[model samples]
Target: MPRFAGKTHTAGHIFFYEEMVVIGAIFGTIFSVFYPFFQFYKWIGNSPVWETVYIILGQLFLCLYGFFAGIFVGCLALAIAEMLNSIPIFARRTKFRHGIGVVILFMALGKSVGSFIYFLKQLFVCGGM
Candidate 1:
């Protein structure tokens, strides 16, 4: 079992990581499937006294969520790249001799800029969300 960080680790640690990922996927699937049945949104909207507090807390929660979500996505991408040996193959195909780090940095920058434009422009809202 390969670790996401490319570090040498014991089998137990690898199993633990796999278990956590599976558990997260299972819970996420369940939540999405039953989202309509969850009344937290309604409760929040109905509570006038706690509305401000809820909004502040909700924003904080979203910030934390976004931070961890970014980490998870970055780690997942790295793991996939390692698994497929994509960098080496890409370099060979392009006859590139060096500056792989620069290529990766540019890719990340592109993604960041695209994401900023997408959310700043509320493109997702136009998708019927």
Candidate 2:
């Protein structure tokens, strides 16, 4: 028997890819973006000695120049995840869609640089670094 369901506007197949993209984003955001911060908070909430460690890490890891650095990372994570979600749809349409990924990568790079600069400023001013 021939494979009846492949492409050409099949609702179920399209939905599957869309769902795949969304799920990938959710997983990526949770694992890459939030896990470290959550672990830090849990650490701080539990121990006294670790509180010092937490603050130091917060200064070094979570802040830049002197401001909260987590926001930039989180935003970049979200942007990358969304771009990944777009991949499934774009891949099916045109070879040029590959270029979309490059664009997304540049966006992510921009986010990273901006976040790093912002945090570096915080590190200097707030003594977080």
Candidate 3:
């Protein structure tokens, strides 16, 4: 959260940012706890109109969720990398003196490819896709 605020140059509003983060966490927790109880799919399944609306809205929600989730993960990964100074350390260890940019690019691409595979294979679920 601090990383997000810092990246946006909104460090001065740290309190507001912290409050928003807390509120989001609370809402997320509540949603997770009550999600099965809601059974939205069961309720909407009978109505063609409602089902179409739900599908469209759900896709839009997922797109937005994915966008923010990507931002958070990217920020987290970069923050950890920067904190450890891993890139420079690795470069020095390998006697590499140039193309740090190339290394960073490959690292990012690797992360993207790995994440894509994880989701494509549905590895998050209990059973394999």
Residue-wise C-alpha lDDT for candidate 1, range 10-37, written one tens digit per residue: 6557778788879989988988778777
TM match of model 3 to true structure: 0.58
Tens digit per residue, CA lDDT, model 3, 1-129: 676678789889999978988998998888877788667878557688888888899999999999989978987888877855877888899999999889788877998998999988888874356
Q: What order do you get sorting by lDDT, best first?
A: 3, 1, 2
TM-score of each: 0.53, 0.28, 0.58
RMSD of each: 6.1, 13.4, 6.0
The local lDDT score (0 to 100) that residue 86 gets in candidate 2 is 81
Task: State which candidate, 1 or 2, has the greater lDDT.
Answer: 1
The clash count of every prediction, one per candidate, is 0, 14, 0
Residue 26 shift from truth in candidate 2, angstroms: 25
Predictions ranked by TM-score, top down?
Answer: 3, 1, 2
